[model samples]
Structure formats: structure tokens, C-alpha cells
Target: MADLVVGVGLRDGVGAAAVVTAVRSAIAEIDASPTDVVALATLDRKAAELAVVRAAAELGVPVLGFTAAELAAASVPNPSARVAAVVGTPSVAEAAAILGSGGGELVARKRARDGVTVALARTV
Candidate 1:
């Protein structure tokens, strides 16, 4: 399986450009073959979560959502038959652990300005 870091923002903030930027950033950061990132979308839409689930299914790249509490607390159901990882701001570390537990790799933003760096560990 391949790994990708998707930056999910508010629909207002997550426009086509933002999604494109996130996907491009992820692709550039990972530097892997066979593009993994499908599309990074914002969570402003009720269907945003669904979009993520569908993309994850088709691309087989684990979809991760990063946002604040207000969005995270949304009642959107997890759509993946397979376990999916969702994280909130300041919870990047926690998301990394979840990634490990799910046999998925995490591209976590370590330094303040260094952007995200990929980290791999065995899950299950």
C-alpha cells in the first residue's frame, strides 16, 4: 500500500487550489512512485467525509482528516469498511499512533516550519 498526507480544511478554505496544493505537497514530500494521494479536500461539505472514503477505497491510500475541534466533532460517520484514521489539530502525534496501529504509514508534521515528514511503523 502507498501513503499520502491529505490536508483537509474548511470548505471555505479548502478550494480546488488548496486540494491541489495538498496533493502536490504530499506527492512532493513523499517522493514515491505511483502517485498515492487521490485528492485532498476540505471538510466544509457534508459529503467531504464521503469523498474521502470513496477516494481511499479507489486509491487504497489511507485517508486522514486534519482539522479543528468544531469540524472533528461533526456527526459525519466513518464510511470506510476498512479502518480509517481521522485526526484533529495538535493531535498529529495521536494520529501517528493510529497509523501505526492500522498498519498504515504516517506523514506527520514534526517541526513547526519543516512541514510534514513520513514515518513508518508496523501496525497489527
Candidate 2:
């Protein structure tokens, strides 16, 4: 139950605001606290995406990015228990699939607070 900041990347003029809204809505559907999730929808650009990542890093929140179907390549700053901020192609199904895969162990859950819900999977 680690707080996950999910970022969605879309094409230019793809209504990033709408996408972000949709992401937030989807996050709400996950049945968790709103503050536990930070959804950022942005256009498919390096600088724009980096800014989002930077902000999340500053906040000490684990960042995740969704582009379309697959995850795009980006270097994320690993501060504390912060894993790589996942950047994938924008797709609700894909996003769900990615998240459902048990992304990884909760390295760091909250920076501002403590007692974060951590989710992890063990591979055989």
C-alpha cells in the first residue's frame, strides 16, 4: 500500500489535463487515500516529463509514468527508497497491468509522514 505517484505521458495536444484527471480518477478507484496517489499527465516530451519527475523527487515520493502501452526510458533520481519512476505509454489497461504486477517492493513510502503500506512480490 505504498503511495504511488503515477505519471501519464501522452502525445502533444492529447489533452494532458484530461489524461491527468482520468489518472486521478483511476487512482481513486484503487480504494485508497487521495494523498496516497499523485497522478501527473503530461505530453511526450523529455523536458516536460523531467520536470514532473523532479517535482516528485523533491517531494520524496515514488514516481511512476505512463505513456501509451509500454514504458518509455527515463532516468529517475533514486532518493531514499525511491525506485525508478516508471514511464509507460498511456493506457488504462496497461497501467493497471503494470501496477497489478506488484511493481516492486516498497522501498520508501512517505517522506512527509511515516507508516506507509508496502507491496512486494517474491519470485521463485
Give the Cα lDDT of each candidate: 0.36, 0.34
The pairs that clash in candidate 2 are 1-117, 2-117, 65-86, 66-88, 67-88, 67-89, 67-90, 68-89, 68-90, 71-88
Q: Estimate each model's TM-score.
A: 0.37, 0.36
**How many clashes show up per model?**
0, 10
Q: What TM-score does prediction 2 earn?
A: 0.36
Cα RMSD, each candidate = 9.8, 12.5
List model 2 lDDT by residue over 16-48, tens digit each: 334444444544455544465533323234325
Candidate 1 local lDDT, 28-62, one digit each (tens)? 55564335443332332322555345544554555
Position 96, candidate 1: lDDT: 36
| Best model per lDDT | 1
Stretches > 4 Å off in candidate 2: 38-102, 105-124
